[model samples]
Target: MAKADNIFNIRGRLGDFIFCQRNGKTYVKRYSGGFTKAATQNHPNIKVGQERFAQVSRYVKSLKQQLQPYLWRQKDGTFHNQLMALFLQIAKNETEKTFNELIHELDSYSSLSNKSLNKNSKIDPSTLLYDAKTNKLNLGIIPYELAVKYKDMYLEVATGWYGVDGEDILLSKPNIQYIKLDKQTKNEDVIVDITPAEESQTQLPFVALAVVYTDDKGSESPHLVHTVMACFVKMRNI
Candidate 1:
């Protein structure tokens, strides 16, 4: 007679059984059918002539590696293993949902903001958030002042127009300013005429704000090839 292969048996519905290999823990679902017939039918077949037997074996191996740290404890106490498994599942689900929400918010904001700008503008939300993530900016969400403060960090003029400095241009608060593009030379120039939009009480002298050059393209020499007109400054205060 052929010797029987060691088979691990799990009671109750398969779906209700939350298996955590990292902790060698198995949980039975209190609600629902415990296991779905569809899940059993669709389960991967690792060996022929084995129904749930193959699944159990494969699951055990996977759990062994995942539960290496808690293997000993799990083997010693079933209750402890179950509790740990449930906690891990809950934590993982929450983390996944949080990250998904952040990405969705960023995408929605970028789309709305960009749509308000000119058609040729390229605003990379991920790149914008990279620096903010390290400092108080946190997850790439740019506050008005912070955005204005870091305006130079995100916007780059098209290459070739050097000597045209943009430090003097004050990004107007609460409104979109149209950037007039001058196509007279190899490098383009951005002109911001704040005279029409200036407040009567303002005392600061009007300054010319132009995009000169930056290290965005890994070139030591300025390449005046790309020009962005719809760029807006993020202000901290109104």
Candidate 2:
């Protein structure tokens, strides 16, 4: 089937995660069996941060004596990565330990974000089109005001080989380029659309959009209907 030029033709509800067509391609879809690793790898940031907590549990297994060589008692007295295995043994629950308490243990030994990394931000960024050939997102059409309003916002588009989710994935160029989001597509950020760096586009599976603030907060609105339509920049071979 020929891909529809408008994102409105490919429709779904707010929570519905579906695929849409554009030009002659589709979003990097999971059902299609392509870019699966990339999509899964680009998991929600919350999942990536959980690893910091999991380590505390593993450290609880080994004995202090066994860890003495690498987990030495430092002069600073504060906990270290090598010592964590030994120190965490003091915990009453070796296996049942929760991330909440483990988080504090980590904070005492290292820096932790006082505020949630992203409390106000949406869990998933708005979806868009990722052009595998160009390594760019075809953020189809969006409100001119939105493009102008959130020009400084970002498209933390992931690029390069997919890794163990986003935790190990290399981030694309920080701030994607933006141009006018209009019908003409002249490639300028006027009062129409936003364009990402032409050279940055990739065959990555999915993307997360955000209107980040000075405080690191973000928002996502990756789709729309009819005229002022907005499609996320995702990639797929089919």
Candidate 3:
């Protein structure tokens, strides 16, 4: 490509040259054309990429549905797209991995409202307490800042699982419980039961904890809520 400094501030094609703008500067280059659909389809690497993408897409779709309650209020596909990329990394690995290993990978990542919650929520996964036997979560203590900022907020505790177990692929619906928060002078500890029904207990379990703020203005933004993966335990361990 060559800079176009002439008086004619040109763009598009003129004879064998093509003119365009780059970083606020005008430039001209040869019209070598571009790839055709047939060329792209015939490329061996591109075909493999297409197949890999399809497989990863299916995996992401299965997992995204179980988290729809927490994700529906999102304005864009940012979370879905990022999740797809994360799943792709797992799918590309050649080493065989179990379902619990896959859930661990997800647990290592941040939650939906990671930015604001990480700075203010104070709900640490390490400190999170859950009793698999009773299906109860001890929501240690409500953060003073969160309590004061959103006095009408509530907590959402969820549990579910998705992945292969033996010859079957388990994708169970999440069991959620909500606890209303009232005005408080100090931090308070809260516990709630999220026991899955007999039918819902068909798979392993992954627990999630979240805070939802009730907006008086009736806004529908998912940003008003923050969620984190509290814990995951294999069915055998449970």
Q: Each model's TM-score?
A: 0.17, 0.26, 0.51
Q: Select the stronger candidate by TM-score from 2 and 3.
A: 3
lDDT, model 2: 0.33
CA-lDDT, candidates in order: 0.27, 0.33, 0.53
- Ordered list by TM-score, greatest first: 3, 2, 1
- Candidate 3 lDDT over residue span 93-116, tens digit each: 623543334433533233321222
Residues 1-238, model 2: lDDT tens digits:
2233444554432243455555555543333234567666677654444554455544433322322321121123322443454334433233345433432332222221111112233222232344545545454433233445455444332222211121122223333333332233334322212233332222223222333332232333332111111112334342
Candidate 1: give its CA RMSD in angstroms: 22.5
Q: Which of the numbered candidates is closest to the native, going by highest lDDT?
A: 3
> What CA RMSD would you report for each candidate?
22.5, 26.1, 8.5
Ranking by lDDT: 3, 2, 1
Over the stretch 1-238, how does candidate 1's per-residue lDDT look in tens digits? 1122234434444453432222343433444343477776666552222533333344334433433321111222333343334334333444434322322232222232212122222223221211112221111322222233333333322211001012121222321132212222222222322223343322221111113234333322111212222222221222
For model 2 the local lDDT of residue 95 reads 36
Residue 51 CA error for candidate 1 (Å)? Answer: 46
The candidate that achieves the highest TM-score relative to the unseen native structure: 3
| 1 versus 3: better TM-score goes to | 3
